[model samples]
Target: MDETENGNLSSDYIAWTIVANVLAKQMNMAGPSAAYNGQAPLSEAQMKRIHDYFFGRLHGGFQIAELAATLGMSRTSFFKRFGRTARVTPNQYLQILRVEKAKILLRNENLTLIEIAFACGYADQSHLARFFKRYVRMSPGRYRSKMREEDVA
Candidate 1:
């Protein structure tokens, strides 16, 4: 492998190691249960409004409090209501959406990571890589390479 590839391999290893260690410690600490407790179901109108808000503004800054206010609810209520209805936190949902868009853009092979990151509402390539790895379990560069290889095959 070339020097750049070697460096990236080591970097990836170190990053993932740090993440694993941190996650293990956090997992042991007492935290809110991930289970869905009984709550009032989101109304169809509420569901539609949220869906429209998210899909329409994937490239905009996402603030949970702002979204909660827009939905006419308090932050705490929005958190519980959204989690119960969407099966994920707002941050998680946003990352997944951005990463999914990035995946599509990666397939083009013409767009740089920076371009994709901006288009996907990330601050920079590093920010995009961080969330992409968290949600997709791989770097954007590696994912793009794999997809290209699969297309060729």
Candidate 2:
């Protein structure tokens, strides 16, 4: 609910989508004939390529069509496959990546939230906070504080 209210899901999920599944495998659970495995969303190699590209361009936002072209996939194919594999839209995946990046960046006491936001490709600090809270369930500042406390402990 919060994700939809905030207009997004967490970026951490994106960082971990982490698979390729078997297509020909038979399911023996339902009398051995209920169904066969569905095709995997993308190959491990393809996911790695997408992750690399997204990481490389993290600081600069991108368009879905542009990303599709970069992957040599049609927009529809890319969207469908990514959605199937990651269980979230490409834009949502990007947001998860951004939030995860922000989490790491928050460890640095010197840089402000605004810097972290831009570093993670958000429009501003508030943008980072909104998504961060939605996905992480805490404000960035509080998260940073908690992390710092953990470090001290």
Candidate 3:
């Protein structure tokens, strides 16, 4: 590895060690979840507006420009603020939300995989299956079968 990578590895190890020692001593000084320093994250109002817009138009194509417009923010500003607030890029958050909705619909047993895919905002069944496997560690079809088995038992 390069010098920078080695330095980062050591820094990460030191940080984790400090956290581990603190946890062992039952010190709750910083807690596990700490807010980052520097640029402000999105406010609650901004987050709520984003959530409302995203869910309301869940099955359609999204544009960062469109979202930025709704919040009166420039695209660059919106991207940075959203990353800070959500801990993921906007598109990543959208995919996760889509997969979650698909999971819920899968339990119904009435919706076919294609229906679930489109309903959850994926382009098609294969698209849903790809991300579903990535996030849930199984294909949607397999996940549905597992859910059905659990329902019976």
Give the range where candidate 1 is weakest over 10 consecutive residues by summed lDDT: 30-39
Clashing residue pairs in all predictions, respectively, total: 0, 1, 0
Q: Estimate, for each residue in 23-133, the C-alpha lDDT of model 3 and write its tens digit.
A: 877855654433233257888998999988888777886899999889887888788889988999887887888888999999988899999998898888999999999
TM-score result, candidate 2 = 0.69
Alpha-carbon runs more than 4 Å astray in model 1: 1-38, 43-45, 63-66, 69-72
Overall local distance difference test of candidate 3: 0.84
Quick one: best lDDT, which candidate? 3
Better of 1 and 3 by TM-score: 3
* Per-residue lDDT of model 1, residues 14-88, tens digit only: 889999999988976855444323256567898788777787788786678887788777778888888878888
lDDT of each: 0.84, 0.79, 0.84
Off by over 4 Å in 2: 1-39
What lDDT tens digits, residue by residue, belong to model 2 across residues 14-69? 43342112222333333342111323477788789888878877777767888778
Error of 2 at 115 (Å): 1.4
